[model samples]
Target: MKVKVVSLLLFMTGVMTFAQEDLKEREQQAAFDPAYTSYSRKKPAYVTLKDGTKIEGHIKDVDRKKGQIHRLKIIEDGKKKVEIQATDIADLYMAPSGLEQLDKQANFFNDATKWGKTDATKHLSKGYTMYTNQMVSLKNKKKPTEYLMQVVNPKYSQVIQVYSDPFAKQTASIGVGSLKLAGGIAKSYYVKKGEEIVWLTKSNLDEHFDRLFMDSEDFKSKYEGEKFKWSLLGVYILDYTEFALDAQMGEAK
Candidate 1:
């Protein structure tokens, strides 16, 4: 019985040792950071159609070799799946930035010298330069209401996003290039519920988030009953890769 007990202990010891070694091996394999320039071009797993439809799926086939159509397959459920001809796709989004994504990957920064080169330099790493594109939902707002806004600067990415929510007053947006932030005087108006964002775009870039918009008459009307969703990519201070912007996810090949 003593011998059996000893064998059991030995087995457990071996298992634990193997587990630790496996973890160490994984860490070693994931040691070096990937180069950026190549990764930046990687797009996300989904695409936005021109008709404002967001399609999430796999690029099972793209016949660009001959035709311009990209055949995609979206799995709604295990059984309810469909394949689509993805020619009308407008935009593609990537998942998230990588390890080499940030130039100075530190939590706290002593660098406040706005747009500096070294640790004392600020303005955010890569360039604080971001790109932006936005789409607005206009089911009943206006006939020419299929609206989308885009900007080509990272300076404008940091903007105040507010809504007419009785509970949550304001939030900050780190969008790509542009946003529609409004300026001042809270309003009381008759309207249906759906407004999402409160402030205007460029205005938030100038003032402190807390002091940006205190009161605005059109605030409630613009965002009280609206749902505004925006995606803000990196100000990517580091000389990153194209794969950072586009992660080749949905592509099957």
Candidate 2:
């Protein structure tokens, strides 16, 4: 009887160890998988379609390839399961979920400076993340393609929208010439105004800066008076957006 009890305890311990190891292995693999970007835990979301249809559901799964969301699986009304293609979705708003909370916690611990990388921190309750369909040109591709773009700043999307470019190439100039070399992962940004969306870079930012911020006297004064850092471009855009919003509100009043 004693031997049997001991054997049973050892068996349980071995099973638990194996389960834990399996879980860890899967997680490590998932970290590198693009499809794993989606939350395994379903989160509340509102999706708008091109034809003006609105869907209220919990997002179950997402399929992404090369940083673009191609498909989504959502549970609607708690019973019906629906699969949606990214092309059909005009936009989507994801409510705060376990995944987003985890992201916040990780960001908070990793870098205090990045805590407010976007205005999402101010409007956490509104929507943790938002995506919109936009025309984007991938690296090495000549033609632009329509894809689901994640909006980095949503505070004043009406005036100008900021998107994190997932398809950006991790390339850097090799020498004095325009010769480039591919390297580790890198990020690029894009700004959209009305129907025009352009990849934003330090070199081309000058061309678009005036047009984008011409209406904002506050931005013009700030830009001219202070030494603006290229790294803080998003901050500058946000400031201009605030000014734009204030003007619109004043006019409305």
Candidate 3:
């Protein structure tokens, strides 16, 4: 009886150890798999079509081979899955979650005018009007000014340094110049204000804001003291727009 009890305990221990090892192996494999990594970062988002149809789902994957998100896999209604090309989506909104709570909700629009153009412009609007990880606002309903903030600098770059040795021997070293690409390096603000496209920088921010909130003393008093940082420009714009919209809604009420 004692031997049988010990044998049973040993069998259970072996099974537990095997299960833990299997789990650890799976975790290590997942870490090395790009698909697995992308899947783990999937987030809830909503895609809107040009015809005013909205589809809510989890963005499973973003195909970004050409420096932009060209395709997206969305799991709709919690189970119904669909893959959408960028051309089909008018806009995409990604919800904030967990550590992303500090980040602004991502909103991208499709700029139709740039479609089928060549050079960097072709990459600009493959089918979608806007780039990922950006904020968009329609300031005027009657005139409809689309306010957009984008990063102009490369997200990543590599620096290579070569040295010549004069003391010992002469040698030649060949290095490959590989391009590193990333998004949201340098910030640029653009506004399509009533038939004109205006680029806003540090110099013009004050002028634009002044014109935008000409009658609102409250907006000026609250934001005038705040220093503008490039990294936080999007957040500031989003907050200011929300505040102005809220104030307008309140006045209407």
Candidate 4:
């Protein structure tokens, strides 16, 4: 009986040891696994501070809350790392590091800008910048379109639903809410023409395009002929603008 008891104790000890070894292996694998580590891995980027200082490093993490990038962790000098607040950062550019030549040329900028409302004094707080380009052109303007891009977290659109509960004394109630999952990241596009910045949408696409290309018969013919798809409206408008600009340039030469 004593010999059997000693054998059982030995077996339990061996089982515990094996379990611990397996757990340790899993922990080590997870540390190096791409799926688990990708979010924490640093990516090359250039950061510009509000005071005009520039820092080049690898981005360790970006903390986005309420649709704003509140903070960023950057790794520098191989071993040193620093956390920076959004207020101190002017912008950041994530360097493209893919095989495609076009991907290499792509620059993603995270910058702050005052957006929304027609009144210059009524603009909302700074928001995240998505795309910046001079896609729209005004007649006789020396410079390209100032800035045209999509912004996130500018403002929330309210939705209200009213319903009556027949079972509960036929009481009528109203529900008001907005997108909870947006986290304030719901986006809207804006364009700056002269001194005014206005929201862009599919409903107003024709009005804006007509105003910009009022004198271009070629543009009108081509634009009217193509069937615009809502999902591809942004792309179509950009392409049409480019075509118009090229035609104007050719005429000048």
Per-residue lDDT over 36-107 for candidate 3, one digit per residue giving the tens place of the 0 to 100 score: 112223445656766777787776766753133557788886477798876676656543233111111112
Model 3's number of clashes is 5
- Report clash pairs, candidate 2: none
Model 1 agreement with the true structure over 83-135: per-residue lDDT tens digits: 65444555433222331333333322333332224321232243321111222
From the highest lDDT down, the ranking of the candidates is: 2, 3, 4, 1
Best by lDDT: 2
Model 4, 17: alpha-carbon shift in Å?
69
The lDDT per prediction is 0.30, 0.61, 0.39, 0.39
> What lDDT score goes with residue 100 in model 2?
32
Q: Give the local distance difference test score of model 3.
A: 0.39
Q: What ranges in model 2 sit over 4 Å off?
A: 1-36, 78-80, 95-97, 100-127, 139-141, 167-187
By TM-score, how accurate is candidate 2?
0.61
Instruction: Please list the residue runs of candidate 1 whose C-alpha ends up more than 4 Å from where it truly belongs after superposition.
Output: 1-44, 66-69, 94-253
**Residue 210 CA displacement from its true place in model 1, Å:** 42
lDDT, model 3, position 125? 26
- Which parts of model 4 are misplaced by more than 4 Å? 1-40, 50-52, 78-80, 85-90, 95-218, 225-227, 244-253
Q: Which ten residues in a row have the lowest lDDT in candidate 3?
A: 156-165
lDDT of model 2 at position 9:
100
What TM-score fits each model? 0.21, 0.61, 0.33, 0.38
TM-score winner among the candidates?
A: 2
